[model samples]
Target: MVWKIYMHMTSMLCLGVAAFFFGGLSLVSMSTGKCSLIEWELSSLNSLTVVFVLIFDWISMLFLSFVLLISSSVLYYSGSYMKGDKNFNRFMYLVLLFVFSMGMVILSPNLISILLGWDGLGLVSYALVIFYQNEKSANAGMLTVLSNRVGDVAILLSIGLMMSLGSWNFIFYLQDMVDEKWLLVKFLVMVSAMTKSAQIPFSAWLPAAMAAPTPVSALVHSSTLVTAGVYLMIRFSSALEGSKIQSMLLIISCLTMFMAGLGANFEYDLKKIIALSTLSQLGVMLSILSLGYPDLSFMHLLSHALFKALLFMCAGVVIHSVKGYQDIRYMGCLVEFMPLTVAYMTLSNLSLCGFPFLAGFYSKDTILEVAFMSMINFMSLILYIMATGLTVMYTMRLIFYSLSGNCNLTTLSNIADEDKIMSDSMSLLGLGAVFMGSVLSWLLFPECYMICMSMFMKNMVLMISFLGALIGYMLNMLSVSSKLSSLLYYKEVVMFGSMWFMPFLSTKNISEAYLVWGATNEVLNDKGWFEHLGSQGLYYTFSKIFMILSSLQMNSIKVFMKTFVVMLVVILLFFS
Candidate 1:
């Protein structure tokens, strides 16, 4: 308990530090309207040199502030959520370390030093994901770490490729190296970002990482861990412009958004739904980054973090009150049990769908509008619009099943919002979800982006939301629409309904195969072939050589005496 309070206080102090930076950056943006970076040369003793830089630009400050804010709230929430765990102190330590890593990723302009923080995050997050000590958590932790390891390795390769420049500080060299000659380096960096951000094939791990505690999901998944990739791409935007990889990333990111949104619709697990919601939002951020609007991407990144964190906290509350049944199908009319939580959930989901005047409304709406205005190919345009619509589809599905439907819960005796620790943390995040977007838009953009497009393009998000609401409503009346499930294409539904077979790929295909290979090598090589060929072979060969040497040594005394006597007799005869 002392540790919990200490962590809460520490996190609050972090929030204060972030608040100070936020104010200073906003004031500086107003005055100078330029980036001010403080770079201290860390190593100049050798041929290799690197700078430790903390960029105090609006983007850095704003993003860092949001990360810290979410960190603070998550630590506070963990005090309640993890109070019963035996290793709660270790949990607090890991969470603080995770936050510190996120801070490193946020403040560093040099990719070399940023890799330190990046790798730290992956290691600590793996520990956190597997903290539950269950088989599911174990698999999830392995997937989470392995997926992120790809990025870590990619960064290392990028650093190696960057050695020609004599420094790994990308901010200093990337602008000059934007030509075709540095394409491999740029591609490595982009691939690293994709792995970190959970794009496409690398995306299977994000939802699986929900095996972590809710606080980890709220802090890491919704904001810090997943956003690191997008944040990196945002900084590397100058070098990445007009690259062929950007086009590929655009397609991959759109697929992630569409697939995650569709998976959320088919999902019944409450935490996983929110987890998939986060994946979709990540795709949105990645999409905008690929479109080369880091400002808007950063904007949506901040706002999405605010509400998505709140959404997870709300899910945590519901799960806690209802005694750990995560399936939304088993949950209904939670509003009757916890009104405050339901309200938070509603606002966050609406914000997720880009509902008017909320945090998600500003950045998400602008992203869609910008995409529509761009001369993208037909498939890209359709996917963008449908992904936006699917946001509403999943949000409504979650709302209808979990919040407003019948009170399907069997045991309702213990359900209540009595935990002040959780309530306090969630209430703060809910406030941010409600107001952060407008404030960020006004501060960051100052001037809104004006685009001329058709009404279909402008209203596409809303139209989809409207239609999704009707479908979601009808579906919630389960008896009336039971046949709709049958009417759906079973094979297609099962394919996407299983999250594009991601669970199978991550848990069964990929991870299980590695486990099998590891076991095979251990049995065949370590205990079998290598034992005989390496350790046992050497033992037997050396033993035989020693035995022969010992026999010769024992005989040497007799043989030498006989030889000496014979030589003496022969010498006497010769002398005579």
Candidate 2:
């Protein structure tokens, strides 16, 4: 245990140092407007070459810095979170593996190398998700891994497609890859990104993955695994510009944003709520990137990672204090007990809601304004507005249920912010949640984005956000005597609450049909027709024939001699 403690401290210290080094390099790269790419030729074949490539740009460097920073914090937090677990050391190793895989994806521009990291992420995340070794964890792990496998296959197909180009370094061929002939490559890449990021049909795994440990959630859902998709799209945004695929992605992301936000408002599970929020934010990043603003997308991705990680960590404290009770309905007035945890949670939540001057506000607000200013269709604009409001509404609902109101847990419950390790870990990301947005915005965008909107349009964001908050607070502030309206519209509420039954659609709905089909096939084919007409039937026929032969053999001696004598007499008569 002491050795494990020393290892944890050592890993955290190393990550912090690496973060600072990369952070400085990122700033220098930004100021100098230069990037370094180092390549090593591994082998060569006819019209094909395999090489390892490392890309060091401000974008990649800064993203790596944040990944390491958050990873270090999460690892420190996990020391306390998983201390009593038997596999604490194994957990640490898996977390480190997860981070290393993400680094590979971040630093490598080559598709083949990226796939190596990508597959590593999928495998390691499955291990992490099932760390608890329970049925729920096992099921969630299976779902998460299988959903990710689709993207893996997509990446594999894209690699096969890239072979025609003779080089896997997509960074150098963005322009050439954008032609109509290369549409399939672009489509494959988009699908791979979507699966990793959990967009639309792929969104079910994000929530299901909350069955993992909270620290893993903070790391996986925030900066590393989920964001890989958005980051991939960011790298490919140049090729996607002015293409039909980009427009299609715009619609898909917006729907994902709205769906996740609305579902979160109805969600009661604490970690799953945060997961849904992550989904919504991913939509914001991809949507903006789909609009031909990769830099803006990257900015949001970074800022969101900071606050979202903080939010998840804060949630870990709350859940840990309550003895792993995650239902928000039973949580209330937590601020009275866990003041520091609640404060940090509120900070992250408000940042998610786009409260002014915070880390989320800088990037999220910019994305909204840029969207309105873009030439998107009216329906897409409506989705943007609706999704934005839903984000605030769900955030407010979370705060109302968990931070204020009356405490519903037992009087004997011990809830306090006394865990120093947990508090210390959260403090780092709390600061990031508060200020990283403005810092990233300024650093990434030296020149200001021009905003030309009417007075009404300019105020629309604040107005919708205010309205959403008001409704969220008012609707949830029901007295004990008041009737629940959700009961009146139970079906509709369930449909909306269940992420439009996507989990069902992804799991039970699809599995149930296939299971029924399998059962039918088993009974009708394997057990019934195949048994009667196949091996079983043949066995019976062969047995009957053997039975006849055995019966004939019983009389065989006399009957055989008589038959032979008759045949010889006939032959003699014919000769005569």
Best by lDDT: 2
Worst 10 residues of 1 by lDDT: 479-488
Candidate 1 lDDT by residue in tens digits, 47-78: 87777777777677767777877888888788
Q: Please, what is the TM-score per model?
A: 0.88, 0.89
What lDDT score is found at residue 204 in candidate 1? 84
Clashing pairs in 2: none
Q: Tens digits of per-residue lDDT for model 2 on 467-561? A: 99998887788622278778888899898888888988999878789789999999999999999999999999999999978866887777688
lDDT of each: 0.84, 0.92
Residue runs of model 2 more than 4 Å from their true location after superposition: 479-481, 512-576
CA shift of 154, model 2, Å: 0.7
Q: Return the TM-score for candidate 2, rounded to 2 decimals.
A: 0.89
